[model samples]
Target: MMQPILTVAEVNGYIEEVFPEVQGQYLCEHIAPMEARVRAVVGPQNLRPGGTVSGPTMFGLADCGFYMVLLAMIGKQALAVTTNASIDFMRKPEPCDMIAEARILKLGRVLAVGDVLMYSEGSDKPVARASMTYSIPPAR
Candidate 1:
């Protein structure tokens, strides 16, 4: 079995240090072989005019989920950047916390591809789904 390059606590700590703006709101919950679980607590600022969770908030959760999976498999490569992303808003989310489950479809030397499903906490149906590709920077 392949070992994880980073632990959940490590990834969460890194995000807190590097992206302090999202501290306490977003967190990396778990890391498995090629999968990651992240959560984003719905705050007042994350609500849209219609009182639903904003689309950008869902997108951010998806992106962060995918990034966490990549980092879990490849270590802390902060320079790794998104190359492409597509998101589908399937359902309106509640004003509760959101969870994103990410699965890495492919992990190559130079690139990674993954998909994410976002759900309102305790809900079975997904609120959004996203596919993303990231460009892994060359090692120095």
Candidate 2:
């Protein structure tokens, strides 16, 4: 198995420097090989009608989680951009933190594909699943 090229702190630092707008919304929990775990801190603003976490919030968590995994394996390539994404909302997520487990399914020279499974905090059942493909910029 390939080891991660970046650490959680390093990845978080890069996000803080470049994507400051999402500073406290998403946090990298772990990175190992081609996998990463991320947490989305759910707040009142993240809830929709019925007091459940919104689909967009869960989608953001999956995107962030997959991005973290890709960056951990490929280093700080900030230009990597999501090219395609699809998500399935399985269950209503509670108004609490959401945990995302992301794994890289394939990594190529200019593209990477990954999937994420998200669950409400402290829950064993997944609330959503997402698959995404990112276009990696060529090295300069």
- RMSD list, candidates in order: 1.0, 0.6
Instruction: List per-prediction Cα lDDT, in the order shown.
Output: 0.91, 0.94
Among all windows of 10 consecutive residues in model 1, the one with the lowest summed lDDT is: 13-22
Top candidate (TM-score):
2
Model 2, span 97-117: residue lDDT tens: 999999999999999998999
In model 2, where do residues sit more than 4 Å from their true spots? Answer: none
Q: Candidate 1 residues 1-140, lDDT tens each? A: 56678999999888887778888877889899999889998889999988899999998999889998898899888899999999999999999899999999989999999899999999999999999999999999
Best lDDT among the predictions, by candidate number: 2
TM-score of each: 0.96, 0.98
